[model samples]
Target: MPSNVPTFTDLLAGAKRSAVHLEMRDTYYSNPRFESWRQGHCVDWNDRASWWRPFHQEIADAVARGVTVRRARVVSEPVTEYIRWEHYVTHANVTAGEQVRWLPRRLASDLLLPGNDFWVFDDTSVEIHHFSGDGDSIEDEILSDPKLIELCASGFERIWERAIPHEQYEIH
Candidate 1:
């Protein structure tokens, strides 16, 4: 028998309007869902070295549209590699008008705290009960919280500040 699994769309039907806050460990961005979201211009986070390709493409897209994309890392190596490989070597076809930013890992954590209003911890083991009082139902709580929207916007700003300018990185 096929088990009834709830998909994001199902959850979204009942979810509130607040912007989502997704938290994942290093490298979750490699998931196909992340790639789809990137292609659609949605924001995401991951701290792994292997995500350079998708990350580069996402950033390049954001830049070309004259949108600012920000990121943060707890460590420097991944960022450095991203700079060298994606920015320097491939010289991915990014537009001159786009802007990118990065932030230290500590700051990334600060923006993800409890008081931020609505948050979405995207992973396999999260249960609806765990988020009961901590925030709102992915289906219902966010629809009413304006604060959550602001918090997400603020988080994006921090990432923007720390990111390196594309041209400065030596695109190969």
Candidate 2:
């Protein structure tokens, strides 16, 4: 694996058409924000300053430049506590002009999902992320292979089609 892989911002920064992210984890091991939420620290969306982060602003800026950003999360039906908390913070994503959707794992049973989560940029390249059993991000691989890109993009489209929009999805 090459150590010069592009970060999410790196990929998005060069995206001219679209950016789609696919997330398939129920819980992540090394996410500080998730840990904070797990420990009862919720983002007060009402407070404008509290929820504004550099990453969110980056998404907003991308949208402003007409780059369509979309995210799809395939989660368990009986949502995990972490998923529930994630749902609450999704407001920031929407505010950043990124489209988000949630699909229950049951609904994805027939789908050919990827083994790892990924972000596809303009259907040209993919940032495939590897996670440990405990959900720690182990590594991210960037690929420009046609077959891999096709699989990831098509998989994301399938999930997005069956997922409920953020505004309509209710946590379990």
Candidate 3:
């Protein structure tokens, strides 16, 4: 697959099963569309300053609607800002019981934590090509060539195997 080619959506829809590979980059929620998606039942790999409120809202909404949300973090600068806002503006709904897989940073640690949900691979450094609808060529491109998805899924599994279970995480 060409690096410049777009295949994410087709890969997602074509996926009989899917694993999401994500990274926590800065400025993720600024996009309106991304915000709308965040409003739905989704999992994120985020270590941003402004992510918690929306994240909390999304988690609460998902839980209310009977959806499971999981998260993972690997030591980005501590979310001091998010913590302050969370403490002052909203009551914390994410309790210690909620499972969040934590991993070390040699590999893609963030991607490993959230399993079975849509992988929001935050490769913000690279230009992400998005595909829409059932374009025959695009479907053929991803289905016939499963390398992209396989590589992503394998990466997630590898890190997942080595990660610490979020059950042990202390809520502060």
Best lDDT goes to which candidate?
Answer: 2
- In terms of TM-score, the best-performing candidate is 2
Summarize candidate 2's per-residue lDDT along 1-172 as a digit string, tens digits: 5547677788888889899999999987747787787788878778979879999988998899899999999999799877887899889999999999999999999999988899999999999989899887888888999999999999999999999999999888
Error of 2 at 99 (Å): 0.4
- Candidate 3 segments whose C-alpha is farther than 4 A from its true place: 1-21, 26-72, 77-99, 106-145, 170-172
> How accurate locally, in lDDT, is each candidate?
0.35, 0.91, 0.38
After TM-score superposition, the amount by which residue 13's alpha carbon in candidate 3 deviates from its true location, in angstroms, is 9.3
Put down candidate 1 lDDT per residue, 80-152, tens digits, no spaces: 3233333322223233222333233444555443332223222111112122342333342322244544454
Task: Score every model by TM-score.
Answer: 0.33, 0.93, 0.35
lDDT of 2 at 141: 87
Candidate 2 runs further than 4 Å off: 1-4
TM-score-best of 1 and 2: 2
Give per-residue CA lDDT, model 3, range 1-172, as digits (tens): 6765545543333333222333333122234534454465333435434445554554455455444434444433343333223222222334411234545454453453332222432312111223333211222232222444455446555665765665453334
Model 1 residue 27 distance off true place after TM-score fit, in angstroms = 1.0
